[model samples]
Target: MIKLMRIDYRLIHGQVAMAWTSAIGANCLLVANDAVSKDSMRITTLKLARPAGCKLVIKSVEDSITALNSGVTDPYNLFIIVESVEDAYRLAKGYRNIRSINFGGAKPQKDCTRKLSVTTPVSERDMQLLKELVNEGIEIEIRQVPGDEKINVSKLL
Candidate 1:
């Protein structure tokens, strides 16, 4: 089953490898990013950063949705990570089982108009997508790591 959906620009990094795996009790980490899925070097680096016992699957957002919907990943407790709000919106629209999304580490974009958290910056487009997700009944929280206090994304906007 899908345990958590996280939005972290640097997916499967040190903080996530250490904290989120144990906290969510996830054995599988799915990175749903088109760019990373197509890049061999990024895939290799992500594999090296993954937790020792956890399995990592890097695929495009569409493929990830298909895998989850088709039960290809039903054997393990899955933690899904996406890089951007647009990707997260796509996942939320395509996957009905996702209950929550943690906004972890979005760097300030050149067009960012507001800072949601120290590491999370939002542009108008990002905020609009997030609001749409919220309206779809998906809970959104801003948290850097499992240890950090979760701030509701709605409150930031």
Candidate 2:
């Protein structure tokens, strides 16, 4: 079962390794990103940052989708993390189980002119994709951490 899907540019870190994982009662952290899945250095870094007693699986977006669709992740309470809104969209579109997304953190893009939160910046392309996701009934929440109150992206957009 998927507890949450988050877009955090920094990926696994303090907040994610502790707060979000505990808050959602998730035992598995499934990182769905193309780049980091293939990077040895990043995989090592993420392994070091992983929460104690929690399982961490890093796979490319497509592979992640296959795992989710094939019921391989059903045994664990899964928390999916991606690096961008685009990647989140891809995962959500590919898998029917992802009904909500959390906007955790994003590095500023060259074309970004708006922010969904202090830690999350949004470009025009990002905004359009967000709108599309909202239209499809996917709930979008903006927050830096689980303790913060969720700000609805649909209302803001």
Best by TM-score: 2
Residue range 1-157, candidate 1, lDDT tens digits: 8888999998888778988888989999999999999999999999999899899999999999899899899998999989999899998888888889999989669999988888888899999999888888889998877888789987766
lDDT, model 2, position 3:
90
Deviation (Å) of 66 in candidate 1 = 0.7
lDDT of 1 at 148: 81
lDDT by residue for model 2 over 58-134, one digit each (tens)? 99999999999999999999999999999999998999778899999888888998987778889998999999999
**C-alpha positional error of residue 17 in candidate 2 after TM-score superposition, expressed in Å:** 0.4
Tell me the spans in candidate 1 whose CA falls farther than 4 Å from its real position: none
- Candidate 1 local accuracy as lDDT? 0.90
- In candidate 1 the C-alpha lDDT for residue 71 amounts to 89
